[model samples]
Target: MSLSKLLTVCVIAISLNSTAAEHSRTIDIDSKVVSNHRATINGERINYSVTSGTQPVWNEEGEPTATLYYNYYKKDKVDDISKRPLLISFNGGPGSASVWMHIAYTGPRILKIDDEGYPMQPYGMKDNPHSVLDVADIVFVNPVKTGYSRILPNKDGKMPSADEQKAQFFGVNADIKYLADWINTFITRNNRSLSPKFLIGESYGTVRVSGLAKELQQAHWWFLNGVVLVSPTDIGIKRDGPVKAANRLPYFAATAWHHKALPTQLQQKDLNEVLAEVEAFTINQYLPALAKGAFISPSEQQEIAQRVAHYSGLSKAFVMRSNLDVSNNAFWKELLRDKGYILGRLDSRYLGIDKKETGDKPDYYPELSAWLHAFTPAINHYLREELNYKTDIQYKMLANVYPWDRSKNNTGEQLREAMAENPYLNVLVQAGYYDGATNYFDAKYTMWQLDPSGKMRDRLSFKGYRSGHMMYLRKEDLKTSNDDLREFIKASLKSQTHSAKY
Candidate 1:
C-alpha cells in the first residue's frame, strides 16, 4: 500500500492513549525462552537470551508501517526489571547492524577470538562475565532495511528508489521519529517511564543518538538519562576540507607510528606527545604546502614530504609526489605493502594476510566480517537455547537502509545551531585511537563547532582509547568502557532528578 494509504489504515486501526498521543500503539512483547545452557564466566554462571520484541514502525513521513523487531538480553530475572536500567543500543554503517555489539560486547554471549585477535577455527562462544546487561536491560535495534527490517510494497507492488528510500526511511528526521515512537511504545508497554533510560550508539549511530535526544524530548517530552557514543563520527561532513583533513593527520601518525610502522622517528616518546607534533606540523606546514601548489619552493615541499613520510610510514618519494595529501585508502595499502598486507579501515591495528584470505578489497581484516557469522550463531544459541525465547522471524541484527542524507542543504552549522539552542542535552563521545576512518581528532574539531554553555560544556565528555573502532572487542577496554558508561549514566540521572526538584 502507498504510505498515505498505510497512514489512513493505521489511524483507523490504532488508537493512541491520551498520555502518549504522539505514539501510535502499544506492543505487548511476550517473553520467550531463548536459551537454557549455562556457562561459567569469571566463576559465575552466566545465562543469556536471543529473544526479540516488536515495536510499531512509522514511515519517514509520520505514517505507520509494519512492526519492528529488536533483540533483547537480561542477566536472569525478567521480573526484576527495576534493578536494571533500560539500554537501547545500536550500531552504525548508516548500513550496519547491531550484531557485533550484541554478541561481542554487552550481551551475555560473546564470540571468541585468538591471542592474535583473529577468529579461531571451530569458533567458540562463551558466557560474557563482563556483560553490562547485568546492570542494564539491553535492547539492540536494527534500523530500517537493516537486519530483517524491510519496506512493505505499495499496492502497485513497486519498491522505493535509493532517493525515495532515504527520504522515506533513513534520514535524520525519519530515525528520530521512529525512535520516538519505539521508545514511547516500549515505556508505555513496560510501564517504566520512571526508570532511567540510556542509549549506546556505535559510529554513525552517534549521529543518530544526538538527534534522537532532542527529538524524543521535543516530540515525546522524554529525556534520556545518558548516551554513550562509541567510535563517534564527526558531525561535520566535509571530509576534504584543509582544516578538517589536516586535523586527521595526527591520528594517522599516531596509529602508524605507534605500531613502529613509520620509517623515521625522533625518539621513543609517548604516542600522544608525538601525535601533538604531527598535529602541529599538519596545521602549520603540511596544510600550507597543499594550498601553495606548484608555486611552493621545491626544498620546502621536499622537507614537508619527508616529514609526512617519516610520520606516516610511507616512502618519502611517494609522499613528495602525492604533494603530501595522502588519502586513507592509499595509506592503508602502501603502509604494509611489503608484508603483502593491508590494515582495516575500521581498525587499522588489525592486519590480514591478503585479499585471497578473505575475498575482500583489503586482505588483512576479512576476519572482522567473518567474526560476525560466529557471533550470530552464539546469539541465536544463547537467546533460543539459554534465555528461552522462541521466535520465527530472523533477528534483524544489522541493516543497510540507514539514511545518509548529506545534501548541500544539510549543513553542519545547522546541526550546531540545534545543539547550541538545546543546552540541556549533553554528549559523551568515545573514540578509538586506531580508528583511521573516524579519527578522534576529527571529533574534537567537530565538538568545537558546538556552542555549548558552561553547563552544557560540563555535560560533554570525550574519551579516547588505545584501541580501534570496536574498542570493546578488547576485553580490558570493554571493562573500562562499561565503567565509564555506568558513571556517566548515574551522574546524568542524578543531575536530571536534581533539576526537576527545583
Candidate 2:
C-alpha cells in the first residue's frame, strides 16, 4: 500500500475507536448557576431563581457515581438563608418524577384544572394562587431513574454496573442514603445550613421521607425542623393482613357517597355526616366481622355482608363473593358497573370507561390519568420554554425501577425513631379523604403505631382534605391545604423550645 493510503486507513480506525468508547455527558455538576425571575404570590411580589439541572452524586472517596436531576426555587434577597424556611420536596412514584409536587401544587405556576380536577383546554399554565413559595424556598428532587436523572460513571472512568446502581440508589436503604446526602450538600452549597429545613413528600415521597429522615440524622447529623407527609404508606404493613382491608372500608364508604352508590338516605346527608356514619360502620361492624374470618358464623356473616354492602354501595351478593373482604379494585369496578364507568383507585371521584364494564379491575385510573395528561405536557413545555433547560432526553413521568427491595422499608418506624432522636422534630401528616390508594384511616393506623405509649405523640399532627392523592388539584383543597401547611411550618419552627419533651 502507498504511504498516504496506509496513513488514511490508520486515522479512520482511530476515529472509530474514539466514537465507540464515547458516551453521552450525563451530568453537568458545575451548572449550579441559574436564571432569576419574579412572580406574585398572594399579595406579595417575590423574586425567585430557578435552577433546573443535574447535581452530582459522589462516593465516600469523593468520586462521582450518579446524577440527581432537580428543579429548585429560591426566594431572592433573603440575604441570610437562616432567616428563611427551606423545604426540600419530592413526589412518591418509587418510579415517579418530582413533577407532581412541582407543577401541580407548590410551584409558582400550575396547570389549569377545574374544581373537579378535570383538565381544561389550551394546555397552558397560570400563576398559582395557592402557591407556598411565598413562605418557603422549595427544592423539587427527582431521584435517580426518574426525570432526567440517571446512574453516572464512577471516577475510575468506568460506567455504572447494575449491582452498583441497585446498591447505591434503587432500593429503600440506598435511596435514603443518596437523597439524604443530596439534601445536605444542597443546603450547604446554597449557604442554608442554618436555615430552618423541612421535607415535604407526597405519596411514595412520604415513604422516602420516613427513611430519609432517619438517614439524615444518623449519617449526616443534618437535623430537620419538620416533615410534611402527604398520603403516607406505613412500611411493613402485611399486604395480606385484615388491617389493609379495614383501612380501606372508610375510603370506600366516602367514595360510594360521592358517586351516590350509598343508600338514598345516606346520600341525603352532608359529606362529613356520611363519612361519620361510614367510619362508624367500618370500626363497629365491618372490622369485627373481618377479624372473625372463618370463625364468623354464617348467619352473622350474612348480616355483616349486607351491612358492608349498604355502606360501601355494592350489592350484598358482590360483597359476599369477596369473602367479607372487598378490595379497592373490586369496589371501584363494582360500584358503578351498571353505569358503564369504572371508578379510579387514586381518586374514586373520577370515572373511567372500561372497554367492557364487567372487568375485575379498571383499565386506567381516571383521576391519575387526567393529572398525568395535563401535567406531563405542561412540564415538558415549561422545562424548556420557561426554565430554559435544554435537553432532548425523554423525561420520565414514572420510571419502572423494579425489584424494589422492601426489607429496609420501615418508614413509620423510622419517623418515630427520628422523632425520638430529635425531640424538636415535628411531623405533619396530610391525607385526602377521597384518596383510596393511601386511605386516611391506614395513615391513622400507621401514625398511631408511631408512638405506642403516646409519650412523644404530641409532635405528630393529622389533617384530612376533600380531594384525592394530589389534594391540591382541587381548588378549595389547594387553598385549605396550603393554609394548613403554612401554619404547620410556623408551629413547628415556633415550638423549637430546644427542651420540648412536648
Candidate 3:
C-alpha cells in the first residue's frame, strides 16, 4: 500500500509487458549519392548526413492515408546496437523544429557563443564533447509541417493553412499519436526497443511533453524511463481562474537587478534572501492588495508600489500609476526605457538598443536569434557529412507549429494524475533564473502540484540555473546543467533498481 511499493509494482508490470504485442518493420537507405561531412570537437571525430524520405501515416479508416517527409540524424556509430539509452529531442513552437536542442545541448553538434554571448563570425559547427549522446543515442524529431516533416496532398491535393495543418496533425493528442507511431517505427527499424527511452523538450515543447507523457503511457502503452522539461509553461499559470497563480515577476526582477540592469541600492542585498522576501510579498501581500482595488487606500497602495519598485527595480511612481497589475510585456518595455535600451524577455541579461530614437519595443535580441543560423548550418552539415546520411529534406530547426489550446483539458491536473497513476514516473524540471517568459517560480509552483505523497514527490528533482531559458548557452551554466542532468538520470536508473528489488 505504500507509494514506493506501488511504484515498484508498476515498474515490474511495465518491464514485464514492455515488449508484448510489439511489431517492427525494416527501412532501407540508399546511400550512393548522399554527401557526408565530418567535424572534430575536443579531439573526437564525428560524422553525420542528411536524408530525405517519405514516412507513412495511417488515415481515420485505419488505412495508409499519406506519406510524410522528415529528416533523421544518427551519430558516428552505425548499427552498433549496444542497447544504449535513447534520447528524443524537439523544440516547442508546435510549429517549431528541433534546431536549438540539436545544435546546442545534447546533440553531437553545437553553435559557438562569443565573449559577450553574441554568436560570433565564421559560423561553423563543432563536435559537442558535452553532448548527452555520449551517454545515450540522440534523435531530433521535427513534427509535421515543421522541419521538413510534411504530409503529401489529400485526394484534392491542396496546401493547408497553418491552423488547418495544426488541426489535422499538430494538436495535443494528434502530436502524441503521430510521435508514438514515428518513434515506435524508428526504434523498430533501428532495433532499439530494449533501450531506455527519454524525451527532452523546451518552451512550448514542455507543454507537448506533458500531454505526450500521458498519451505515450495510456494510448501507446509505452512507459518512459524519464523526461526533462526545460523552461516549462504550466497551462494553469497561463489560464484565468480562481486558482491564485504565483507571481514570477519578482524573481525575474531580482535576476535583472543582479546583473546591474536595474539599480544600485537593491543590488546590495543577498540575492537569495532578497528573492525570498520578494516572493513572499508577491504571493501573500501583493495579490491581495491588487484584489482589493481602491478600497485599500492610497497609503497602502504607495507601500505596495514601493515594494514592487524595490524588488522589480522600477520607479515607485510608475508602479503606483500602473495599479500594480503590470504584465510581462509592459515590464520588458518599461524597465529600461529611460536608458534608451530594452532587455530580452527570453534572457534578461541580453540588452538591445532602440532601433529608432524612439520606439515602443526594443530593436531585437540579436544575441539569441543570431545563433540560429550558426547552429542550423552546422547541424545540417554535420548530419550529412559526418553521420553519412543522404537526404534532400530541409531541416526545420525551429517553427511555431503547435499553439497551446486552453480549452481541451486541465493541463496541470492531467500531469498530476499521470504521475499519481504511475507513481514510478520521475521528472527533472530545469529553469533559468533569468527567464521571464516561463519564470523559475512558476516551475516550482507546477512541481508542487504533483501528488504530494512522498513517492511521487521524492521522484521529482528541480534545479535552477543563473542563466536564461537556454541555460546551456553559457559555458559555466551549461557545464552545471549537464552535470545535474547526468546525476538525475543516474538516480532514475537507480530508482528502477530499487523497484526490481521490491
Best-matching candidate per lDDT: 2
Estimated TM-score per prediction?
0.79, 0.93, 0.81
Output the better candidate (1/3) by TM-score.
3
Worst 10 residues of 1 by lDDT: 24-33
For model 2 the local lDDT of residue 247 reads 72
lDDT per residue for candidate 1 within 16-36, as digits (tens), equals 443365542333333333433
Q: Which stretches in model 3 have alpha-carbon errors above 4 Å?
A: 1-54, 60-83, 155-164, 235-246, 261-265, 355-368, 388-393, 400-406, 452-455, 500-502
How many residue pairs clash in all the candidates, one count each?
26, 2, 28
Write one digit per residue (lDDT tens) for candidate 2, span 118-138: 898878788886778888999
The lDDT for every candidate, in the order shown, is 0.66, 0.83, 0.66
lDDT order, best first, reads 2, 1, 3
Query: How far does residue 344 in candidate 2 sit from its true spot (Å)?
Result: 1.0
Clash pairs, model 2 backbone? 92-204, 92-205
Candidate order by TM-score, highest to lowest? Answer: 2, 3, 1
Q: Which candidate is the best by TM-score?
A: 2
Tell me the tens digit of each residue's lDDT in model 3 across 360-409.
45567644665664676676776566555445656666555546444564
